[model samples]
Target: MRHAHTVEQVRAAEAELAGQPLMDRAVAGLAATCARLLRERRGRVYGSRVLVLAGSGDNGGDALFAGAALARRGAAVSAVLLSPEKAHRAALAALRATGGQVTTDQNVGLADFARADLILDGIVGIGGRSGLRPAAAPYATAPRTGLLVAVDLPSGVDADTGEVAGAALRADLTVTFGTHKPGLLIDPGAGHAGPVQLVPIGLRPPAAPVQALQHADLAALLPRPGAESDKYRRGVLGVRAGSERYPGAAQLVVAGALHGGAGAVRYLGRPGAEVVRRHPEVLLGDGRVQAWVVGPGSGEATVEALDATLAAEVPVLVDADGLTELARRGPGALAGRTAPTLLTPHTGEAARLLGGAATAERCAAARLRTARELADRYGATVLLKGSTTVVARPDGTARVNPTGTSWLATAGSGDVLAGLAGALLAAGLDPFDAASAAAYLHGLAGRLAAAGGNRLPFGSVHSTVGDRGEAPVTARQVAAALPAAWRNATAPQGGSQQDAAGLGD
Candidate 1:
């Protein structure tokens, strides 16, 4: 698991190491990474043109020290101080001692930014909540040939929420220290962050509010049948989805449930014949089930299905039209439920659930906040699906899904996800674990289907199909790839295939 600490948490942890050389450790790692990237881009670090965009904070100090280190190693390093008067005195003197050039001219900075082999973006620290200052805004749109590496985080992105308020420096790679920030894991801040590399400074903080699960984490959480396991013992998943108007939603949901790790799938809805025709093994009409999946193309029948599902003592997952009905009825309908309730909604549905001036655009911009608010208000586990799928628990803990492709933005993808999560719930995982595992597997399946096979290594960090030269895929194809994704997640880590960073393109 990759833990993402908030700015306040990072500060508290850093305070514990006040007497130590934290800045030195950070600079060493930054300089080493820059050297490695320089060597990879060109032939060597020596004689490479490096530019540092220095702000008034510790981030600027770190960049200047790193630039001085590069200058010592024969790299031509230049520092453009955005806040010349407030720059770190020690760091500035150190750079000057190393024969590094310093300038406060915006024109000189832009020129250096254009032609430098590498640009270190330390113009803003994690504390910065808004967009870039006017002096440094030009770098946001300036054309550059070399790689732009962010020191801790890209300037102009909210460290806690991943909301890019205005023009933010888009980095080719972000070298973060201590631990990951929530912004680097979620979009549109994630979109600006190309690739992230964590540089540990030995600051141990409290439990992280945000986390991303890796292959091993999922492998441990995934349920597997035992030797003497019967169909009932494994777990039964009850699905109430689709209507005559939108029968395809039922088909997709059932497909996802069947492939999911459930022992049996009992489907109840208007599209029973169609479902049976597609999947003969599906049991028509609902018997006793460990969990129930309601919604997903439910149309006019959503209210009835939701009431019936809610009446059951078993765990219930609400999505799609069911989510709309739940939003209309408010959280009162789920007030007396003894069983767990998992609410899955895309940005639009989430906005409706939130109500009161909440729009899809606002929900998308502040995904973490939106999911947390919904979870708290509804008193249930909320899975807000989007470019970065966030699973938020009512207790304030959350997990950001790091696996997925743009291809998952298909029509019935959410239905497939709802069914898969319901199956996990039936398999006896808690709401948080069920939702997190389902998102991970669903994302991997989408990647597999988009690639047309397991052409890319299982659990690859490339988040998009375009990252690996793949094609578009349908929701049906995504469901079909579930088994392969399951096997990959359960595969031994010692094997040739393994997952690296959970967050990526």
Candidate 2:
């Protein structure tokens, strides 16, 4: 698993290492990475133009020290100090000793920024909550050909929540120190931080609040049937989705459930005939099931379905119309329930569940916060689906799905996800594990389907949009690709375990 620590946690860890040369370690890693990139781009670091956008604080100090290193190696390095008065005194002195040029002039900085072979952004650090200040605002829209590398994280993004309030620098790569920050792993901020490189500085943090599961992690969590396993022993999933108005929802949900390692799926809704036609393997009329999937396209019957499903002492997954009904009834409806409850909601649905003073647009901007709130308010595991899907438990611990694609925005996708998650719950995984695992598989399936069934590498970092060479995919195609995704995820790692961890070069 890839762990993401908050700024406070990182600070605490740094405190433990009090007198160590943490800055030196960070500067060495930063300069080395810059040197490698320079060689790759222009054949050598000597005589190459490098620009450092230095602000106040250690973030800027790291950049300045790195600039000094490059200068010693014969690179033409220049520093643009956004805050000259507050810049790190020792770092500035080091840069001057190496003959690196420093200026407080904005126009000169813009000119250097335009022509440099490489740009290191240290205008803001992880603690920056607002957008770029006036002196550095112009760089946000500046046109440049060279690669822009963020020192620790892109400026103006919340370290804890991944929220981008306004203008922020977009980096081609980010060299983060010690550990990955929560902002770099989530959307909005993640979108700005292109690819990340971890540079350890020996700061040991406690338990991470946010985590992303990799291939080995998923492989360990996946439920495999033993030799003595039967249909009943493997686990049966109960599906209460679809209605007369929307029969296709039923077919898609059942399709996803069948491939979720569940032995059998019990269909119980108005669209039973349609579901049976698409999947004759699905048992008609539920008798006994380990878990229940409610909602999807059950328009008018949502109330009845949710009531009946909740009455049973089994793990229940609520989605689509079921989420709407749950929102209407309030969190109190779920009171006194012993079994785990999983709620999957897109941003809009999540906003509704939150009720007072919440809007879809606001929730989208603060995905981590919104998910935690929903999980706490509903007293269940909440999976907030978006460009980055976040699964949060009532205890505030959360996991972000790293495999999501914009191609999954198609209709009926959520229904499919609901079925898959419900099936995993039936297979005996807790709500948190079931939701996280299902999201991982579902996202991988979407990617596979979008790429015309071509098997992509497991745990590869995916953009908000689909990966390169991918085409649009329908919900049915996504469901069809689940088996392929499952196989790839469970495949033996051999020597490619590092690639399976999603650590980029």
Query: Highest lDDT: which candidate?
Result: 1
Candidate 2 stretches greater than 4 Å from native: 457-460, 464-466, 494-505
In model 2, where is the ten-residue run with the lowest total lDDT?
A: 494-503
**lDDT tens digits by residue: candidate 1, 130-205:** 5888888899999999999999999988888899988899988898999999999888888887778888898999
Which stretches of candidate 1 lie above 4 Å from their native place? 494-497, 501-505
Which ten contiguous residues of candidate 1 have the minimum total lDDT?
Answer: 494-503
Q: Write the per-residue lDDT of candidate 2 for residues 173-290, one digit (tens) a residue.
A: 8999999898988878888888788898998999999998877788889999999998888789999889899898888888888887888999998878778888989999859899
Q: How much is the lDDT of residue 211 in candidate 2?
A: 92
Give each model's whole-structure lDDT: 0.90, 0.89
TM-score of each: 0.97, 0.97
